[model samples]
Target: MTYVKDQSFKQDSLEISIAEPKDYFALLKPRVMYLVVLTALAGIMTAPGHVHGLIGFVSLLAIAVGAGASGALNMWYDADIDAIMTRTRTRPVPSGRITGDQALAFGLILSFASVFTLGLVANWLAASLLAFTIFFYAVIYTMWLKRWTPQNIVIGGAAGAFPPIVGCAAASGSITWDSVILFTIIFLWTPPHFWALAILKSQDYEEAGVPMMPNAKGLDRTRLEILIYSLLLAPVGVLPWLFGFASPVYGVLSIVSGLGFVALAWRVFQRRTGKPADSAAKGLFAYSILYLFLLFGVLVIETAGALILNRLG
Candidate 1:
């Protein structure tokens, strides 16, 4: 459906008439938020200190809200490009279900509320990290890097990586090496994750005038970059075990998963030029999600077991 860009006073007044609950919810980008919550929870669970039950719940909720705020701001700013890209054209802002001004207001309100509430219920360090995360994803990555450079996702990945660090700070009231390792894992993992999708969506980005890696760099270079990052990601995945924060089981699982990740990435890299990179890219993309889930899942399990044992003792 083509949405008329009606920015007149009459249209602005009709904003409430066109809006719905789902439209607002779509602003949250719930799927992406889920991964953020998982990694953040993993960081909180694995930290050496503890948080009260209520406090932990509140921190996670605040972080989720902050992530939603970032998503809203991104959609508001990218409405023009989003309307051009097939994958994003139907989003609320681009589709005209929500006005950009309303979306902007919604995001700003949530951003401030999430940060201040987290600070009050958790700690200032965690709150500050969330505040920076919102700013980075919204202003730095979304506004500047996304339009200006091929390295957009690479640098923007830090915004996604901050959740775990914030979670660690919220739980322990400070940062730890373990949380930093988690941050590094996600940071390194982001390029391969998004680049695989970028390879498939290069045409969309091209039409939208966005400088995704697959578009700015050639497909061959993009594939090589994916492989290089995948190689880096493998070792970082095992850092938790190497640093003595995880059990041998977790180490073994991480190694196995990392190898699987590398194998899939290699398959993408080895595919003959233009023969069909999608299958391999899709495989790697799917596997990357599973690989992260497995890594963090093990952390959660081990931490839960330790907590149980401690209580029993």
Candidate 2:
């Protein structure tokens, strides 16, 4: 007996809650979009400029809407494979909560609305980038890369990595070293973070006919790549401090967290002796998300602290 904000289409439409905003929000994948919006805001906040509160709110909203649109489109396109993968089988499209056509229409309408609103409220450049991001994730990543090559996540990672840049562009209308650095950090971080999951979920993917790194390359090779990328991610994570953008707090946290990430990779690489080979990979996969969240969280807090210090000064 969930209530609908509006009428919804479902058997026992009474059994389904149409009025609750949560269900529709779930179709938008708000949890995933929250991370996207946070990272994007961090990039915008850390950059050397000021965004007005109203404009900033609209900008974030537009980016968020665009992200949701992308998720809907992704779910729409991947509904078939999603139905097969246990991890994704419960998604709105696959679980009978939302139809693929409904998702497609929802995504397209939101995509256009977000872009048009952003361009009207902010700038065309950012709006255009948002449009491209939605298309990139929905089409390039979900539709093509996910099924074609083991390098799927590697290339597909770019879709997720674009949000920060889009936020930066929304704020400043152009790219900067700082913005590009933020993009670089996320871009480089994506491969290893996802490959960890791929390693563990190789079977899930192979069964679904998706070519992830672990399936394309051997497990040992994938582990090596994860270690390598993690090493790169550690130093890149600290570029804010390297470029004098933040205080030493960021540098210290980045170094410590980065080291921890590398250590986790090492553990997975060497001590992978017990349980299914998937266990070690799964451990790395889960930890990698924590690592990135912590890494970015530190940067966001560090920047906010600096803003307060400057305000006091």
Candidate 3:
């Protein structure tokens, strides 16, 4: 009877110790990771030289892991506020599926492993950039700027913009104007994209005490700021073509998409009350995602097509 009781206790303990794999995956913030991978691929493809298949694969994997590590750390650190916000209450750390300690450990371990692997397979410059990116997002953005200032997303946007630069460095062992252009485009795109969502979720941010633009500066101010960023982003989005890396097709697509972004922002700026306002913000937020994906997708497609043509020639 004693032996059976002990065996049952051990089994229960073992089961309790195991967490669901999907919960762990959620800590990685896979949606954010997907964007990181896409921008990083564009960086690699647009760089000046060819990368070996194995090296390119390894570098991208390392960057993805590093981005995941940053996400995990962000979730761990923000778990307290996350629980207070409706938008984030269901995340792994806040939902009771993952403990803070577990997330911190997971993030730290992955951060070290990714930087080391990237340095081994690519150049240290790329690895160092990845390390800085993780640190910036986890420490600077999450621990400091996010709660302290309304301009958090503006400054913290650099972390998201670094992936392309890292990818470019990994492929060419150096940063170039092309990579900087990619970085600039994403950096400019972040504020308008996030501010649009902030308009819709300002109440959640206020309750959580996060100083998002809409909460800190009022909805009117946030709307104006979004419009301004969209205007700036329009011309910057066309830079790759002007720099000679992208074709006229990309230029035309960028101009048209940029105009659409500005138009959406203008609607958000004009609609200031009730369902109209919410719908406009929602529309801008959704279109911002599509706009970014379209621009980067075109760049990747053009690069791939050129490479194929050269191979056949």
> Which has the greatest lDDT?
3
lDDT of 3 by residue, 143-187 (tens): 999999999999999999999999999999999999999999999
TM per model?
0.94, 0.90, 0.95
Candidate 3 wrongly placed segments (more than 4 Å): 1-15
Kindly indicate the candidate among 2 and 3 with the higher lDDT. Answer: 3
In candidate 3 the C-alpha lDDT for residue 238 amounts to 98
Q: Is candidate 1 or candidate 3 better by TM-score?
A: 3
On residues 202-306, what C-alpha lDDT tens digit does candidate 1 reach at each position? Answer: 999999999999889888899999999999999999999999999999999999999999999999998845646689998989999999989998898898899
Give me the displacement of residue 88 in model 2, in angstroms. 0.5
Clashing pairs in 2: 3-19, 3-20, 4-18, 4-19, 5-19
Candidate 2 lDDT, tens digit per residue, 80-153?
99898888898877887777777888899999999999898879999999999998999988888788887777
lDDT of 2: 0.82
- RMSD to the true structure for each prediction, in A, is 5.2, 5.6, 2.7
